[model samples]
Target chain A: MRILVLGAAGMVGRRLIDRLLAEGTIAGQAIDVIDAVDVIAAEIPATGRITIDVKASDVSDPDEITALIDKRPDIIFHLAAIVSGEAEADFEKGYRINQAGMSHLLEAIRAKGGNYRPRLVFTSSIAVFGAPFEEPIGDTFLMAPLTSYGTQKAICELLLNDYSRKGFVDGVGIRLPTIVVRPGKPNKAASSFFSGIIREPLAGQEAILPVADDVRHWVASPSAAIGFLMHAATMDTERLGARRCLTMPGLSVTIAEMIEALRMVAGDEVAGRIRREPDAVIEKIVAGWPRDFAADRALQAGFTADPDFASIIKAHIADEKQRVAQAGA
Target chain B: MRILVLGAAGMVGRRLIDRLLAEGTIAGQAIDVIDAVDVIAAEIPATGRITIDVKASDVSDPDEITALIDKRPDIIFHLAAIVSGEAEADFEKGYRINQAGMSHLLEAIRAKGGNYRPRLVFTSSIAVFGAPFEEPIGDTFLMAPLTSYGTQKAICELLLNDYSRKGFVDGVGIRLPTIVVRPGKPNKAASSFFSGIIREPLAGQEAILPVADDVRHWVASPSAAIGFLMHAATMDTERLGARRCLTMPGLSVTIAEMIEALRMVAGDEVAGRIRREPDAVIEKIVAGWPRDFAADRALQAGFTADPDFASIIKAHIADEKQRVAQAGA
Candidate 1:
């Protein structure tokens, strides 16, 4: 199996690469070649059996996208995107990179014009759903994104379905929830605090809680997110029918509940590192997001979420431990 | 009002143009210049008060699209598209014209750049909703179009909402139901039979009924469709918020009910011109279409439907009578 990972420098992309390396195969096929692409140069993992190539490339550039497609990777993991805050603030850059970039990539693949139908696993987001929910958003709720970033993702989902339907590509879009305990520094996404409050505290650092404790949101662990992408790559797409996009299963937890879980997992000292600092802007932005979802379709299709917030914290701790051990070695 | 109507040669576009000429204005502004564009040159209506220019143009061409935007029409009625059957048969042409054409027009408008936010009235379709519907599909149902034509329209709807939200264009997309009692010859559209059964019979000609009489579908009269477009041009869009696409209200009637309405309006002689011909291809296509809709949002926004199928038949007769009178004069 030849695999290509876009946004390979990002946290999920890096972790996914590591997981792929450990498994040495996807869907039981041995890995022959792997291409990792990003705007910034991606790290090429040292491997003896598999050929690994890492390169800096912008998806927005048609030539760059064509170059990636030339390798004809069996599975393409498209995870590159500007975060919510950045997309909202920089309109042109956002649309160019997110919307036009995806379109260009799809067109490039189509231009290849052969029996080559690559499996494209795209990462969509829960941001695709906006506010004023009547109930826990179901699998069939309309996509009326309140933000530019969400709109870009929703549009890409439409493209994915269309391309798949036309036989140009075998596409599966997984609308991932806000990834809990994202193992990285704070990013520009308004929902960044959702991860910061947990990740920062686990590392013995003070993290700001921008919103009220009562405010709830849907989330999944990083491992679960990676799992969704891997499953999407190998799943029986015939079951998907025409609707190629699925909202992945996620745990719905309030800020207070997350803090409680943290306290349970890493004791009172780690949980105490969170500071309640009101950020009206972030609060307003998060207010328009979906709090919960009934992602029955994804669940039926064999996608799973984190068992609970406590387990999510434990998983993050374990990952950090592994990273430390590797660095020491 | 300087008006531009793409696909101005089509039945609805021609009728809309006629309605505009009758009113002498749109949104309370006098009609100064009206440009009608289509793949084939549209017939220029001879009018003393309004300056009308009809021309042949392919919307898929960026230069042609830019040329249309240069006119700076206050309201743009974008109704051009290859019907379902044609789109399905010719894949590349469908995406090029339906999808790329719409995108080019939006980009052209955005490129104008200096406070040029034209009121763009886009004609979407009920095809945006696929089969296996649960009761009446609502305004908030997920768009999972089964056909390439539906996929194109659904994608355009997303683009319309995004562009409107970004303040690039003031766009309102109306998802029209199957137009019944159409005043023209049969076309390749799968739903063409819906109009054919009523239209050909009214003209004292035999019409084929391709599916079972119990098969239900959503429909609206030509006049009602025009009303939706005109209202969309002038309606206060603030009520729409981020979701700009609306499923227009229409009569939900079975084939039996439609025939009954025709008999009631035009007598048994006209209704008897129908022939039962089970076309498997058309039946399969029509089966996947929307049967009914709970268009609460469009209704609340003041878009109305024909009270019943009989009224729709009567409206078609009334329109025919007016056309006859105008020709005689």
Candidate 2:
């Protein structure tokens, strides 16, 4: 199997590459070649049995997209996108990279013509849903995104379904929840605090809590998100029928609950590192986001989420410990 | 107000043009100019007070679209599209014309810049919603189109909302139901039979009924469709907020109910001209169509529909009589 990962420099992309290297196969087929692409040069990890190529490429460029499509990788993992706050602030850049970039890639694949149907696993986000929900939104709710970033994702989802329906590509879009304890520095996304409050404290650093403790949101672990993408790439798409997109299963938790989980996992000292310095801008942005989802379709299709916030914290700690061990070695 | 109608040669477009001419105004403003465009040469009706320019142009061409945008018409009525059967048979042409064409027009409007936000009234269809509906599909149901035509319209709807939200264009999309008692001859559309059975019989000719009498579908008259377009063009869009597209109000009835209504309108002699010749292909296509819609949003926005199928039959008969009277005069 030949695999290609777009946005291979991002946290999820890098982790996914590591997982792929460790397994040495996807869907029981040995991966002989791997092409990892991003706007910034991606790191090429040493795999004894597999050929790896890491390159810097802009997905919005026609030539770049065409070159990648010409390689005709068996499975394409598209996980590249601008975060919410950045996309909202820079509208043209967001639309160009997120919307036009995805369209260009799809058009390139379609232009390849004769029976070149690749399994495309696209990572969408729960931001596609807005405020004023009926407790927990069902899998079949309307996509009336309140932000430009969400709009772009929703538009890409429509394109994925259309391209898949026409048989140009075998595509599956997984709408991921806010990834909890993202193993990275803080970014521009309003929901970045969802990860920061947990990640920073775990590393013995102070983190800011932007919103109220009672404000709830849907989330999944980084491992679970990676699992969703892997499953989507190999699952029986025939069961998806016309709806090619599915909202992945996630844990719903409030800020207070997350703090409680943090205290349980890392003791009082780590949990005390969180400062309640409220940010009105972040609060207003997060207010429009969906709090919970049913995700029954994804659950029925064999996708799973973290059992609880405590486990999520433990998983992050374990991942950090592994990174430290590798560095020491 | 300068009004532009893209598919000005079609049945509804021509009727809309006629309504516009007779009323001599839109949104209570006196119309100064009308640019009616289509692939074929559009006829320019003599409106003593208004200047009319009818042109032959394909909306899919970027140059042609740019030229239309350069004119900067205040209200743009974009109703151009290939029918469902044609789109299904010719996939490439469907995407090129229906999907890319709409995108080109939107891009052109955006390129005009300088705060040039035209009121773009787009004609969507009920085909955006597929089968296994909840008897009456709600206003916020997910769009899962079964046909390429439906997919194209659904994609356009997403684009419309995005563009409108971005302030590039003031747009409103109305998903018209199957037009019943059509004045013209039968076309290749799967739902053509819905109008054929009623139209041909009213003209004292035999028409085939391809499916079972119990099969229900949503419908509206040509005049009602025109009214929906006019209302959409002038309605205060602030009420729409983020979701710009709406399912227009229409009468939902089974074939048996439709025939009964026809019999009451034009006597049993006209109704008896129907022949039951089951067509498997059309039956399959029609089976996946939405049966009914809960268009409460459109109704609340002051969009009206024909009270019953009998009223729809009467409206068609009245329109035909007016056409004949104009010709005689």
lDDT score, candidate 1, position A322 = 90
Native-to-model Cα distance after best TM-score fit, residue B45 in candidate 1, in Å:
2.5
DockQ, all models = 0.74, 0.69
Task: Give Cα-based local distance difference scores for all models.
Answer: 0.90, 0.89
Report the Cα lDDT for residue B180, model 2: 86
Clashing pairs in 2: none
Backbone clash count for every predicted candidate, in the order shown:
0, 0
Q: What interface RMSD does each of the candidate structures achieve? A: 1.2, 1.5
User: Clashes in model 1: which pairs?
Assistant: none
TM-score for every candidate vs. truth?
A: 0.97, 0.98
What does candidate 1's lDDT look like per residue over A190-239, in tens digits? 88899999899888899999899999989999999999999999999999
Model 1 Cα lDDT, one tens digit per residue, B1-329: 89999999998999899989999988888999889999999886598799889989999999999998998999999999998878888878998999999999999999999899999999998888776676789877888888888888988998898889989999999999888888878987678899999989998899999999999999999899999999999999999998999999999999999999899988989999999999998888777778888999999998988889999999888888988898899
